[model samples]
Target: MSSFGAIMVSFPGAAHRQFGKQIYTTLIPFGVMERFLMVDDDVQRKLNKRRVKSIANYILMGIKDGNLCFLSAITATCRGPIQYNEATNQLSIDISTQMSVNDGQHRFAGVKMALDTMRRKVDTSQGQQRLEYSEKLKKLEDMAIPVVIFGNLTKVMEQQLFHDLNLLANKPTKSVSLKFDNSDLYNAMAKELKNENEWLIRFGIETERTSLSERNRELMVLSTLRNMISFIISGTDKDSNAVLTLENYNTWKTDVSELIDKLFSVLPEDCNDRSRYIIGLAATIQGIGKYINYLINKENLSDEKLSGLKKVDWKHTNPHWNGAGGTFDPVKERIVFGGTGGGVNGIYMKLIEINGPSI
Candidate 1:
């Protein structure tokens, strides 16, 4: 059994020690982290930030004691940021919505306190724990913090530590930037695939008793493809170089199919073919990659390479549509973007209507 789980509760400060132990021991085995949602009133909000952080400290303290907790956010939607009160030695939330949400508010406040507690207790020789706060925030004019949660906590924790230690660090807002250079995108895509494969292999080895491994592996691959495609299309106008122009979009479309084929071949045959097909179309539109590097390398690249690129030649493989005696091409048969037909090569993929769960 994997030791990961999450739970919600009405009480914010209860069962902290035991809860922490369970998180480290039981939940870790199950690959779970229990998330507690507690309701606090305005009075609780006004308390010293340390008091708020104590709740997190107490829970994490339990996890530390039990040796069961390792902070991670692979399965949750969470954000973290630090808000500072210049006048008081307090840090308030920059985004108060998290504070409004019962669970999020406490989680944020508790995380800060946990770091503070750990930092103050540090002995140079005992260095089992590291101090994370720094003094950089004192120089900034804007004291507000961006909202962070779950996986993002890793960064937030570091940022808070930088602040606590009176060290200057990168702003929390800057750390979350997803801008990709053309080459960086390809490296990211490759790394993403490698990570997915590792997850697949682990799931296979760890869940031998059940067939859940194959399903999980497929889902991860599919998700990576979806994310990669979106990353490519996102902010193309602002961040893209001259290479990603509409003239070459068609070839990019074909490359997307090739990329999907490569991704699918890496998966176990147990995966559904329908997912494979949809993923191919999605990848052409949203992949984050460095094909532009190749274009730059090939200075002689001419119109011949891009001529047939805009065409979506794939036959529709949807069993449901075929069963109904309908033949609708899932490709550039429809208009997209500002183009009236075939979406001016694969530019249609960028059109808002090409909807799928991947988005």
Candidate 2:
């Protein structure tokens, strides 16, 4: 019979022992533990490919020799153990028995896939390279993932645990995460901009997940501003290479801050008047940011040359926006910035048109 070995410590919390219950916890290696941790089809959430890939990338990037990334313990309900020794605090988990993962199924999947990928890479390498890859694969396989084994749980209890783990926890919104993420250059810049600009703070720029509710609010969401800054600096929203390296942070920061200040100063006093101007719309702002990036990178336009943006007719009612796939709806008195790629391209082209032959 196949078995997995673990050094079990008495589970924490008095509540675990109150009902004449004894619980044990163990940190198991990925290679050995992956077999037993089964994803229950009925209880588990549907797997998201994007999320799994992102997690796997994080693990690959973060984990190194003599350094390890921390992942929260995986909670699971186990069938009764095959055997345990009171003296040694060692436990044997039978491979034949059933175990259902109550939480961290995505994490489990990501780790397993990452290990497999490493193994495949190792297998394909040759000579010294093979040895290096093998070492990394071994390290990943031996990575200890803490697992809390709750024994003698009924089906109902398992279901309840699953529900509690997935549903009860409050997940932070993207805006909140971006606002608090000091590590990201764009996020840090957004925070700095908020602090530097009294007008933005006064307009009640939302740092949280919630959107601007009042019509009078001049600024968009904090995350939106972060994206705008990212586009302005990088020329593209997701271009990592365009970002300022640590060596030139101060220089880049000064440049970006100055550009942002100039851009904001020229905008109309009623920036939130979406009915009259496209500048009030979030999509329009993003489009204009991208266009500004193009002018900086492609045209090499100075701040003085950029002053021409103030002359453009930004109103949605302007005939310049009237085309086959127009963004403005005169009847509703609003600009309909569509979410599709075509819609975005249309807005970008319209901005380019307004900038004229010199742009």
Give the best candidate by lDDT. 2
The per-model lDDT (C-alpha) reads 0.31, 0.69
| Candidate 2 local lDDT, 279-324, one digit each (tens) | 6556666666777787887787687667877787777777776551
Best by TM-score: 2
lDDT of 1 by residue, 1-359 (tens): 11222222111111112212211101111111223222335312344565665455444434422222223221112233322333443432222223222123444455545544544545332333332222211211112223222222344443443344334533332112222212234333433443455433442212112112213333333323324443444423223343443456556545544544443444335433233432223223232122221222332323433222223222235332222212344573321123212221242332212222122
Runs of candidate 2 exceeding 4 Å displacement: 1-32, 64-70, 82-98, 117-146, 154-157, 196-204, 216-218, 240-251, 272-276, 319-332, 338-344
lDDT of 2 at 305: 61
lDDT of 1: 0.31
Error of 2 at 84 (Å): 8.0
Provide the TM-score for each candidate, comma-separated.
0.21, 0.75
lDDT for position 28 in model 1: 13
Considering summed lDDT, which 10 consecutive residues are worst modelled in model 2?
9-18
Candidate 2 TM-score, true structure as reference: 0.75
